[model samples]
Target: MRVTVLGTGAMGAGVAQSLLREGHEVTVWNRSPERAAPLGGHGATVATDAATAVERAEVVLLTLFDTDAVVDVLEQAAGDAPTDAVWVQCSTVGVEGTETVVQLAEKYGITLVEAMMLGTKAPAEQGKLTMLAAGPAEVLERIDPVLRAIGAKTVRAGARVGDGTALKLAANAWIASITAATGQSLAVARALGIDPALFLQAIDGTASDSAYAHTKGESMLAGEYSAQFALDGLRKDIGLITDSARATGVSTTLLDALGRVYADASAAGHGSDDIAAVGTAFTKD
Candidate 1:
């Protein structure tokens, strides 16, 4: 497959590397060309412009920050995409945003698939993330091998544009809510002189154990703030979840509260740190 990956950020670069390892011809483009440097040595061609990146690719993958960024890139590449090419949207945009992308792709006669991933950069680079996919059945089948190369599992949400986005938002809401609760509980435990490790062990012993909890708990205990996923990015995802829930007349009090915590973390200068740094927001010396 000739693949073009837009927005060469952490996840984008990971996606590109995964595809390259699978023997696909990969082209990478970022608004800041400097960001594409790490991918260049990995057999990826860096595109000087967005349009040039999409011109020759059979599949275009988007892993941008938000809906607006996705739109901006697509608009810039409007004239360069081949009519039969498939546009795989792997960003974590909300329901409305996904719908808009569907419309734009239809207008341009491009096959569009909403593909939202369910893990961070490490898993992405290892081709071990889970993909929530929704779009035309044939299109999904056509891209199954490429998706499988980059994800451990590909769950078909439905054959509709926004279904995958909706599922991703719902999954992220659980992630944000659970992470917030874990951070607050750990803060209380530490203040009461309970060892963080002991608390984590007990929690992992129960049904409450989860991958996010374990990973983030270990990071909290070690004070490792590496940006596997950044605070601001998680904040944006939480906002998208809450907004989508509200638009659909669903209640999301827990997600709303988590969004506040993320916003506070961002405002307190931890925005660039890993999202697990949310623990620092509640910790008191």
Candidate 2:
């Protein structure tokens, strides 16, 4: 597959590398050339612009930040890309944004698959991410090789373009909730002069145990805030989650509160750090 990946940020870069490892001809572009430049050494052809990147692409993956970035890049590159090429929309741009993407695909006559990724940088780098996909059976079958190169599993949300986006938002709502809840428990334990490690110990073999707790909890304990998934990125996703929840009458009470915690963490200069930095919100004076 000749794959072109736009927006080579942390996640996007990993996705590109994973494709390269699978022996696909990969072309990458980023607004900041330096980010994409690194992939050149790893067997990816770094394009000078989005338009050039998709000219020979068999599949174009939009791994950009938000709806606006995705829209901007697609508009710039659509004319140059093959109409038969599959555009895998992998950004977590919520349900409303997916509708906009669907319209763009129609306007340009491009085949689109709404495929939102699950898992952070590590999973993306290892080709272990779960892909929540929604599109026609034939289109998905056509891009199965591309999907296999980037994800460990492809979960079919439905045939409708927005179905994958809806499922992605629901899954992200749980991610934000559990990460915040884990941070709170750890913070409260230390505040009460209890060993936070003991909290992990207590839940080690219980029904309440979660692998994610230990992943983020240990990072919080060590204050190693290097981003696997940046706090600000999760903050953006939380806002999308709240908006989707409110629209569906799903009660944004918990999500709204969690959003505030992430907002505070971002405001406190931890925006570029790991989501474990949310623990600071509970401990701050």
Candidate 3:
């Protein structure tokens, strides 16, 4: 399988490396040429532009930051993409933005699959991320092997383009909500003079135990603010959840509240920090 990966960020490079490990011919492109250099030694070609990278690839994986970045690259590659190419959009853009990609791909007669991954950088690199995919059944079938190379599990939400995006937003909402609750609860525990470790241990003993909570709890305890998922990114995902819920006539008060918490964290200058830093927002002065 020939693969072209755009964006070359942590997630993008990780995906490219996964493909290379699978013996696929992978070409990677980043806006800053230097960002793509690290992949060159991995037997992956680095392209100076999106068009050149995507030109001859059978599968194009987009792990861009947001919808705007995705549009910018596609616009630059307008007339150069192979007509029968399969575009796997792995970014977690909102529903409306994903629908636009579907429309544009249809206009170009290309196969577009909405593939939003669950898990962060390490899992992506280890090919253990879970992929939520939706699009034409034929397209999913054609790319099953490629998807399997990067994901340990792939769930087919439905055959609609935005279905995958919706599923991603809902999943992210759960992540944000649980993270916020954990952060707030730990703050209360500290206020009452309970050790954070004991609080985590107590929680881990119950049915409320979850991988998401454990990971965030450990990060919070250690005060690690690395960008596994940046605060601003979670803010964006929460906003998407609110918007999608509203569009579908669903109540989004909890999501809205979580979005505000993240917005506050970003406003306090932690936007680029990992979302686990939300714990700091509840700290005493």
Candidate 4:
């Protein structure tokens, strides 16, 4: 497949690498040209500009920072984009932003797929991501190989444009809540003069235990917060979830409170750190 990817950040670069490994014709562009540099050695065409990148591909993948970036890049590329091209938007652009992307797709006569990547750097690089996909069946079938190349499993959330983003919100909220609880759990364990590992041991055989608990708990213990999924993106996800809930008159009491913790962590020095660094929020408090 002839593929163009915009925004070669951690996730984007991983996706492009995996696609190239699968022998796809890959073209990539990034706001910071250096991020896309290593991909050039991996058989990808490093595009000079966003529009130049889009002109030659049958599939366009976006993994940008936010909806605004996604919109801005697509607009820049729209002038040269193929009208019948399929755009698999792999960014988690929130509920409202998903709708906006859909409108843009309609306006430009392009097939749009709302694709939500449900893992971080390692999973992305290893092609072990769980993909939440929502879009037309025909377009999905057209790009199933590319989807398979990037994910361990691909689940179709729905046929509507924004359904994948909604599923992404649910998954992200679950992850944030777990990380927050883990922070509190370890903090309480330590303050009470109990080894944090004892808490890990206690939960080890229980249903309440999770892989995330172990992963983030170890990060807490080692004080290693190198980003797999950065705290900033988690903060954004929290805000996105709360806003979406409020839009439908749903209660976001807990999520709203969690949002503040993540926001404060972002305001502190942990924005670029791992999402597990939220453990610092509880420990410091």
Candidate 5:
């Protein structure tokens, strides 16, 4: 498979490397061209421009920061990619943006596959991402190798543009809620003079314990929120979930509250830090 990957940030760059490892010819393009350079060591062809990257590729993956970036890059690549080339959108643009991007696909006459990845940097590098995909079966069939190389498992959410993004929003809302809950539990333990380690021992192997709680809780206790996933990105996902929930009449009570907590963390200058730094929100002013 010949693949063109746009947006070579941590996640995108990792994904491009995964495709190259699978022995697919990969072309990578980023707004900042320097970010795409590191992939060259792995035999990736660095494109001078986005359009040049898409020109000869059978598959194009979009891992940009948001809907607008995806739109801008796709508009630049639209005319160059073949009509039958499957354009897999792996970014998390919420419901409204999903609709607009679907229109953009029609405008460009490319097969659009809404495939949202469920893991961050590490998983992308390891090729363990769960692909929550939605598109025509014919389209997916044409690009199965590309999706399989990027994700360990490919789940077909449904055959619509917004279906996969909707699932991603709900999943991220739960992630935000649980991540906040994990931090609060750690804070409560500290207030009571209980070692957070002891608290984990109490919940260990119980139904109340989850791998996320354990992993992120350890990071919180150690005061290490390195950017596996940045706080600002989580804030963006939270806001996207809240916006979608409101438009669909789903109560935003929990989602909005978590959004504020992440907002506070961002305001406190931890936006570049990992979301595990959410623990800081509880202890700081």
Candidate 6:
């Protein structure tokens, strides 16, 4: 497959490398060119500008920051892409953003596939992401090779363009809740004069145990806040989640509290750190 990946942030870079490993001819571009430089050594062709990136591409992958970035980049690059190119939108842009992307695809006469990926750096690097996809059957089939290179599984959300984004928001709500709950548990343990590691040990093989809890908890315990996924990225997703929840008549009580905790973490200069930094909000005064 001749593929072009735009916005080579952490996840985008991972996706590009995964494609290269599968022997796909991959072209990559990023707003900050340095971020895309590393992939050149991994067999990806680094494009100097967005317009040149997709000139020879059969598939265009988007892993940009949010709605505006997606819109901005595609506006510049989509015109230059091959007319029949299949576009895989891998950003976590919410329901409204997906609508805008759909409109953009329509304007260009391109096939759009909404593929919201699940998992963070490790999964993306290891080619094990779960892809939530929505698109026409023929288009999905056309891009199956590209999807398989970067995803362990492809879950069809629905035929509607925004269905994948909707499903992604719902999944992220659970992730935000569980991550915040883990931070709260670890914080309470330390404040009560108990070793937080012991709290992890107590739940270690119990029905209450979760792999995600231990992963985020260990990072919090060691204060290793380096990002596998940045705190600000999760904060953005939470905002999208709450907006969707409110529009659907769902209660925003838990999401509102989670939002505040994460907002404090971001405000305190941990926005670029991993989400385990949320533990700081609960632990610090």
Number of colliding residue pairs in each model: 0, 0, 0, 0, 0, 0
Q: Supply candidate 2's per-residue lDDT for 168.
A: 89
lDDT of 5 by residue, 207-255 (tens): 8888888888889989888788888998999888889888879899998
lDDT of each: 0.87, 0.92, 0.86, 0.89, 0.88, 0.92
Off by over 4 Å in 2: none
> What is the lDDT ranking, best to worst?
6, 2, 4, 5, 1, 3
For candidate 4, write residues 1-285 as lDDT tens digits: 899989998899999988888889999999999999899999999999999999988989999989999899978887687877889888887988888888887788777887789999988888889999998888888989889988999999999888899899999999999988988899999999989878888899798889899999889888899999999988988889999999999899999889888887887899999998898888664
Q: Per-residue lDDT tens digits of candidate 3, residues 1-285? A: 888998888788888888888888999999988989999999999998999998998888889988898888877874687877888998888988897787777677777887888888787888888999998899899988889888999999999888888889889988898888888888898899988777788877688787777889889989888988888888988888898899989998888788778887888888998888888777866
Model 4 steric clash total: 0
For model 1, the run of ten residues with the poorest summed lDDT: 173-182
Question: Please, what are the lDDT tens digits per residue for candidate 2 over residues 26-76?
Answer: 999999999999999999999999999999999999999999999999899
Clashing pairs in 1: none
lDDT accuracy of residue 70 in candidate 3? 84
TM-score of each: 0.97, 0.98, 0.96, 0.97, 0.98, 0.98
Order of the predicted models by TM-score, top scorer first: 2, 6, 5, 4, 1, 3
Candidate 1 regions exceeding 4 Å error are none
Model 6 alpha-carbon miss at residue 225, Å: 1.2
Model 1 — TM-score against the truth?
0.97
lDDT for each residue of candidate 6 in 1-285, tens digit (9 for 90 to 100): 999999999999999989999989999999999999999999999999999999999999999999999999989988898888998999998988888999998898888988899989878988999999998888999999999999999999998889899899989898888888899999999999999899899999999999999999999999998899899999999999999889999999999999999999999999999988999999666
RMSD of each: 1.2, 0.9, 1.2, 1.1, 1.0, 0.9
- Worst window of 10 by summed lDDT in candidate 5: 276-285
Higher-lDDT candidate among 3 and 4?
Answer: 4
Between prediction 5 and prediction 6, the one with superior lDDT is 6
